[model samples]
Target: MYQRRTAVRRRKSRLPSYAFVLAVVSFMLAFAFPPEQPDEPSARTLPVRSLSAAACSVPPPVSQGAEPSIPSSDGEDGWMLTLVNPWNPLPEDYACTLTRLSSGHSVDERCYPDLQAMMDACRAAGLKPVICSSYRSREKQEELFQNKVNRLIAQGYSQERAKAEAAKSVALPGTSEHQLGLAVDIVDLSNQNLDSTQETTAVQQWLMAHSWEYGFILRYPNDKSDLTGIIYEPWHYRYVGKDAAAEIYRQGLCLEEYLEQTA
Candidate 1:
């Protein structure tokens, strides 16, 4: 008569096998799923798009951001606008050609150290540029502006219209680029003439196309009238340093836009 008694086994049953199973499960998860990234936000975070070209080729649409405060009337907006649309190279900060049309039209000797160098470059490059206009005081601008207003009025323009028209080319004293003595109008100096070819001449053309090399720019271009607030002056070149001019010309951005970003 044998009594059947069940004894519990105390021996460890395959500890390594349990560990191997856990390792397999971990490996499967590692292959099937990716670990979280540091840059990625948590579940509660709102997703954000990256700014790289792959994510957004163009800038986010404007007018969606908080609006800038409206500036006051006394050039408050003018400052914001001017800051937003700065006139680069401010006057005479950059070296450029200063031509003398008459006896009184010479640049201060210091303001023209590069004249000889510029002349040498022109001669070496076979560029014959004649100086057309030069330094004008604030009084001169007033005089010139009045003259333009008078002439326009004589041509059947209303007084208001004449004044506005004259304002374009003749800056209201102290605001003229020429006053800084760093601007000039150059053209083919052949026959010692002042008038440039309406289109850039071979000489002027080359100069305009490569003016940045000498720290100059065409000053005004048709495409940037709204920004420049001046008519295109293909012959006009203002010295703004080689790097700045190169950047300006290369980017094809107007002085206003150029100044804005820089400021």
Candidate 2:
């Protein structure tokens, strides 16, 4: 009887110890191998669902100052923005002080410094930029216009047709920008011809890219010919002052477009 009772007591004691060991093993296993958690998103790996929602949302309104303000045309630099075209001829009272260049060409004295700096920069950059034509008297303009008309007539165009065609290529004497002394025909020394081919020259490429830095802009662009009322003459550049030039360049605007916006 005594042996049986001792055996029962020993069995009960082992039961409690066994339970304790089982609990400890479970705790240790939990610490060693924790349950998996969901992954967090990074900026680059944002959830697709969230991204879709964002993409569908309405865009924020543009700020008031988002677009650049057009410069004032009535400011002290008003003369720099003078508009000369077929319709707007040079005023009878218009006059500018002339500054002659080494090549016997002249530009407006007001724009001389910028013009000189532009040419200096071009030469410094290993370019051979030449001012082939600059300021022209009314008589010179008339002669050039007549020469164009004569050439067209020789090509079998009627006198009336030739006159109209010539005016398109060469501005009518009174309406020529050359008379204002703010425009110049710059050409690469390698190719002195004034045509679309000039756009391909190194000197022209440089001027097109950087002329605004020196207060000039390509006077006529190929696509803007309708608005400018002149064919694309890539060699021709006009002084509009640095402020207007920079804005015009940034906006991909021709001189007429820039003036219209400010007006």
Candidate 3:
């Protein structure tokens, strides 16, 4: 009985010594080699992915005052070349006086006269051009974008996938040119649908051929979606001033390409 007790005590005493030795080794190892810490990113080098969803909606803040006007090689109003897209976002302070059309849709007051002239010319040509969509506020743009995302989600796309697909059709809030009051979606009065079929209408044919004359261009042309980051929207016309519009049409260049070449 005594032998058994002595053996158990010895085992218990050895355990404490073993634990103390293990702790000392651990301390020594820790002191000899400190853990390596990850390097922190500089403020300027911070990734966009780290931003919140709301921050991601609009692009990184670009100083409105600091924005350089695109060079006007042909004396086009450089301001007319303000580029807004998935990568380039509309400045937060962007403000324009809206002029409501007879159809109740509003557009930038700066482009109203040219837009009216274009519509009159189209009518004179016996083509019925109808302004179906014009300037959309950020709220309206968000609603349209969310509706598209929801539709894609209903079709079994994951949330992230749905948002990406939706962006191709409906521009996210500040990324849409419509928010600048410089873009209008015109359709045929007889067939008022926003789709590829609209491109076949007489109104689209007339506008496609002559919109540049009125300081507007077919904003999204066929096969240029890779550059525009949006689908071919034949009816969407953007007012880039007559000279720039004419140059864009002549070069068969989308706004992005035109800006890059001009820049």
Candidate 4:
């Protein structure tokens, strides 16, 4: 009877040992091979989040005495941010008070002072900044565009090809910024060609670097032709006011992009 009782006790003790061994092994296995964890989000997602946040954030108000808020087309201050492009044509009857340059090219009266100042500054720096072209009526713009297209066709291009190629240099009629009276085509007086080579002239170089100080920007920069939908025209400049010009310069943004971003 005693032997039977001892055997039972020994068996019970062995069961506890087996249970403890299994518990220990399970604990060790958990540490050795843990459950898989999900991957963290990628860094590429940061910009999207930031952009989303920025989209929802309100832009700070312009300071007192700073350039006035950009206005709609009907407002007196509308011309400052007016956009003219193939996709955005000028309205019929769109007009501005114009002041004529010595070259007989006219610009918006509001921008005349800055234009004169820019030219005077250029002269003071021993550079001759000639105003080759400025504001144009729709008729004049049509004539210019047609002339360019005709010349391209004469060069053996098809009518469709000529129109497309000509448009890179001459905006179609109402789409021209010149019609807005805020654009100017300037060239070195000594080198009076509106070609890509104009960018190498001292006057052109100076204007590109400093025109923003006078509210002008290289309207069709070589790098931004894709965005501007125009060929690189180093001789062309546009007046967008000091504040807008400064921001555009700082951001390295084309006028179209700037207007879009601000809008």
Judged by TM-score, which candidate is best?
Answer: 2
Task: Compose the digit string of candidate 3's lDDT tens values, residues 28-54.
Answer: 976897643334321221011122223
lDDT of each: 0.53, 0.76, 0.76, 0.74
Report the C-alpha lDDT of model 2 over 45-132, residue by residue, as the tens digit.
Answer: 1011111112212343434444445554544465677777765666544556689999999988878999999999999999999999
lDDT of 4 at 109: 82
Residue-by-residue lDDT tens digits, candidate 4, 90-147 = 7656667688877788988889999999999999999988888899998999999999
Regions more than 4 Å wrong, model 1: 1-104, 108-111, 190-196
Q: Candidate 1: deviation at residue 155, Å?
A: 0.4
lDDT of 4: 0.74
Clashing pairs in 3: none
Give TM per candidate.
0.57, 0.73, 0.72, 0.71
Clashing pairs in 4: none
Candidate 4 ranges beyond 4 A from true positions: 1-76
Q: lDDT, candidate 3, residue 118? A: 97
Question: Per-residue lDDT of 1-263 in model 1, one digit per residue for the tens?
Answer: 11121112122223355588877777788688765434332233111111221211232233434543322112212221211011222232223234553435655233355544665677688767676766666567568779989999999999988877766665555456665565666667653343334444666767767677766677777787655656676776776655556777887865554553343
lDDT of model 3, residue 73: 26
